[model samples]
Target chain A: MEEVERLQHYFQVLSDVNRLRIIKFIDKEKRSVSEIVKNSSMSQPLVSHHLKVLKNSHLVETQREGPFVFYQLTNPKILDILGLFEEMLPKENLVSDFSPMFCCPSWWGNSN
Target chain B: MEEVERLQHYFQVLSDVNRLRIIKFIDKEKRSVSEIVKNSSMSQPLVSHHLKVLKNSHLVETQREGPFVFYQLTNPKILDILGLFEEMLPKENLVSDFSPMFCCPSWWGNSN
Candidate 1:
């Protein structure tokens, strides 16, 4: 159950576009907060918050150099998860392509 | 952008514990609403609602047999996503074993 909570929290954090973008910022190389803001539309505070969430999820790691903090991926395997989820998402199965074969408005199994 | 919404919605629904359990029910074989309710502690309406969400995500499909409705997985590929995410979740990386490698509270890259 604890593992379930951890996984759900991980997905919850990744469900945000901003957070995904932050991952992209460092996907190629380690980035300082300043570098991310320079390339991304997110403000400093927002970037900081997103990074904290990402770090807490272990999706990324941070290194401190004097006053500069550099953020890079802690779990590179997360890239595989993100990439696979994107690839498997019901891309073609959007509403336009999806329809029930013969769904019932009610299933009689529930008598209670 | 549309794909992003679809993926996010899919994850959002899956982020729930109940929904995940419903998925488990239908994952192995087709189950009528009553079958799910009979076997699981969930109420009928709750099972139905979760099924609708699953169906909308193309994670499950429905078919009618005479008067009985059967719910089954529409996209078996989703199993891989679930399995992979579970495997990749910071299971070992959980805070019990995780420690900061010298991260700063601030990232200097973001000025704005």
Candidate 2:
């Protein structure tokens, strides 16, 4: 693909709220599909679908540990892009920064 | 719109190649529609359409000087975002940085 086309595809893949949320959830550390679904409050199928798109775009990658699959960002530079976007946004539009969680969503009472 | 939705829309607006081209053209200084059309080699209507979308998204702001309208980026931080993206891109996929030109494309040997 041409340089412009690849960038257009990358931006298109990033043009989703759910995908951004999922990306943020998995930024600092790898997470299982269930963990992403739980943190994002998105359905398992939907989370998986977004993960597939992210992986296809080379924005994300995965590893297998036993029966579990872990997904992580392919490049840490993605976080830098996200940070720039956040900086451009209005303060009111800002969300709290992602804090990686090892425990279940219910156990934390929705701090994410 | 919600924060996520607004961000999604922002990214969606940025997902187009022409829009990115136009944004880069107007990054440092304001340029008239005719100027953009000349540099982009895009039709007048297409350039106008992309400019309208960018204006609507608050990505580009317009100022009228007599009969001609000039567009400039709303924030300079956008360049930082573009810089980060360029850094993340493969070396072969990268394009030369924009050098603002006051003359017609033919006046120079397509150095841009």
Candidate 3:
């Protein structure tokens, strides 16, 4: 039941575009609130709210270094979820063919 | 971009507990709107609305068998997504240990 709840919560957290963007951004490296705000072009409050949701969902974990809170993907376990999604969802041959969207390095970095 | 849209749409469709329950039901066998409504204890209109959303998302496809429209999981492709999610998410040992939640047979059937 806890696992179900966690999975449900994770899915809910991923449902938002902003949160998904945040996850995508943070996928590269741990980021402070301001950095995420800058990259996502979302309001601080909105980002904070989504971060709270992500935190509660266990999709992300925060570390306070000095005055800044650095947010990072906590559970590498969720990568399995992303992996499953990649396999299950329709694969874009164009993205994979021309670009390296499915490639490990590109997918793991913010270069794409 | 189409693939991303489809994935996002599918995730959005799965976000709802009611929709998830509906999908879980249809996973076993194709079900009519009325049967889904009865099993889920939700209203016909609500079920119809969800089915429409699921259909639009390509998570579930409908077949008009006689007068009754039967809904079934359209893209077995989404199963790969589910598989990736299972790998990424925290594994429930209890569910897998005692019962066979992760097993193919039980997962494909209506039986718990």
| Highest lDDT model number | 2
Candidate 1 global CA lDDT score: 0.72
Off by over 4 Å in 3: A1-7, A90-112, B1-6, B77-80, B83-87, B90-112
> Which of the two candidates, 1 or 3, achieves a greater lDDT against the reference?
1
Model 2: which docking level applies? incorrect
CA lDDT, candidate 1, residue B17: 70
> Model 1 - which docking category?
acceptable
- After the best TM-score superposition of candidate 3, give how far the Cα of residue B48 lies from its true spot, in angstroms: 0.9
lDDT of 1 by residue, B1-112 (tens): 4655665666676777777777766776888889988878889998888777777667887888887789987777777677778887765554332234554455755321
Listed per candidate, the RMSD to the true structure in angstroms reads: 7.0, 15.9, 15.1
TM-score of each: 0.76, 0.73, 0.70
How would you order the candidates by DockQ, starting with the best? 1, 2, 3
Q: Which candidate's DockQ is highest?
A: 1
CAPRI band for model 3: incorrect
DockQ for all models: 0.31, 0.18, 0.13
User: Which stretches of candidate 1 lie above 4 Å from their native place?
Assistant: A93-112, B92-112
lDDT (C-alpha) at residue A111 in model 3? 32
Residue-wise C-alpha lDDT for candidate 2, range B13-96, written one tens digit per residue: 778999988988887898999999999979999999888777766677788889899999888788777767756843442122
lDDT at A38, model 2: 79
Which 10 successive residues of model 2 chain B have the least lDDT summed?
Answer: B92-101
